[model samples]
Target: MNNSIDTKRIVLAALFTAASFALSFIQIPIFPAAPWLMYDPSGIVCLLAALAFGPKLGAAVAILSWLPRVFLDPFGAPMGMLSTCCLIIPTAIIYAKSGNTRAGSIAGMVFGAALSIVAACALNLVVTPLYTAVTMEQVAGMILPILLPFNTLKMVINVVAGQVLLAPCMNVLHSSKA
Candidate 1:
């Protein structure tokens, strides 16, 4: 493991980031329990990194996953890129550092889900009011209650999926350890 930034690592991470971005953009549109909610696989890509690599790599890859989204989307920085950082990086670190045991997987999921809920609420507090007038603010409040829970569910779903799939992924990762 090189301490400083290696070009190889950077390029590989860029590929990971691209995979994540592609996953997020590919909207398969699962039936979300909440209004205007959708499930995506990008978070799984980030978790895959955490399981295969270490915390620092996980964090960096997580950041890469969202940076392009922040730029390309219309509602760009309103949710605060920092909020995404808060949710994804720590979750990745927790999973990476724990060495991906069953207990650690659950703990990581709980941490990530809770963080996502908090960040959504906080960002909505600021971004919601700014994006719309008073009439829209009322709608925003109504929307938040519906949406937050669904986001939490997404975290839970991803964690469970990762836990089930980790062994297979690890096998593939291991074979390439040349």
Candidate 2:
């Protein structure tokens, strides 16, 4: 029985990871000025795994999902992975600690979104210049106008999608427990 449960968890994680990786390819340009800053729903999938399982597993899924990009897209890989982790980890931890309730999910999403924005801004300030021709001053200047809004919008979308999908996911998870 224990082995079966573990197997189910592994399978679920693998599915979530693969789904996220596939979803990463479906990017939508959110900000017109920065078309390079595309949005993907992979984070939503990772957060769902976290909500259904636990933070560690969710994080594992997120890393696995983002691993492909790290090798294939060197320019934005580090920042992309870091930003996604910044969003998923905090939200997952909060949700897990709060007993995975609806309220906890909401709070976690809000907190995680805010944290992602800040982390993205700071990270871009430090790392953007390394990958692009942009200077530190340019990156700093763009943070408030571009980076902040972009990350906020992206996170909000993922949070809302996660919330909408939560009930169904919970149903499956609970049923699996039996």
Candidate 3:
């Protein structure tokens, strides 16, 4: 019985990860000024998995979801995957610790969104210069105008989408368990 349960969890995680992987392709530009900064629903998928399963499995989903991108888009994959992990881990941890309730999901997503904004700013300040000709100063200048609002909007979309899907996802998980 334990083995079966574990198998089900693994299968569920894999399925969520696969869905996230596919969702990564459906990117939309959130900021008109920064068209290169695209938003995807992959992170929301990871959050849903986290709420249904546990943080560990959610983290697994986040990492596995980015595997394809690592090979397909060598230039942006690393930073994108890192940023995604940064976003999902905090959300999962908060949700898991808060008892994984609907309220906890909302709280977790809010916290995670805030964290993502800061992390994006810091990462862009440090890493963006290494990849592009832009310096830290230039990136810093765009933080308030571009990165902040962009990340916030992206996270809002993720949080709202995750909340909207949470019921159906939980229903599926519960039914599967039975």
The TM-scores, one per candidate, come to: 0.76, 0.92, 0.90
What local lDDT does model 3 show for residue 5?
Answer: 50
lDDT score for candidate 3 against the true structure: 0.81
Name the runs in model 3 displaced over 4 angstroms: 1-5
lDDT of each model, Cα atoms only?
Answer: 0.65, 0.85, 0.81
Candidate 1, residue 43: how far the Cα is off, in Å: 1.5
Q: Write the per-residue lDDT of candidate 1 for residues 1-178, one digit (tens) a residue.
A: 5578667567667777788778877655444554445676777777667556655676677676767777675353335244445555666667767776767666776686678667766666566666566344564675556656665666677777777877787787677556
lDDT at residue 162 of model 3 (Cα atoms): 86
lDDT: the better of candidates 1 and 2: 2
Tens digit of lDDT per residue, candidate 3, span 1-178? 2424576777878899999999999989878999999988888898888777666677788888988898887656666666666667777787778777778778888887787778777888988888799999999999999989998888888889988999898887787665
**TM-score of structure candidate 2:** 0.92
Q: Model 1, residue 166: displacement in angstroms? A: 2.3
Candidate 2, residue 37: Cα displacement in angstroms equals 1.1
Sort by lDDT, best first.
2, 3, 1
Query: What C-alpha lDDT does candidate 2 achieve relative to the native structure?
Result: 0.85
Off by over 4 Å in 2: 1-5
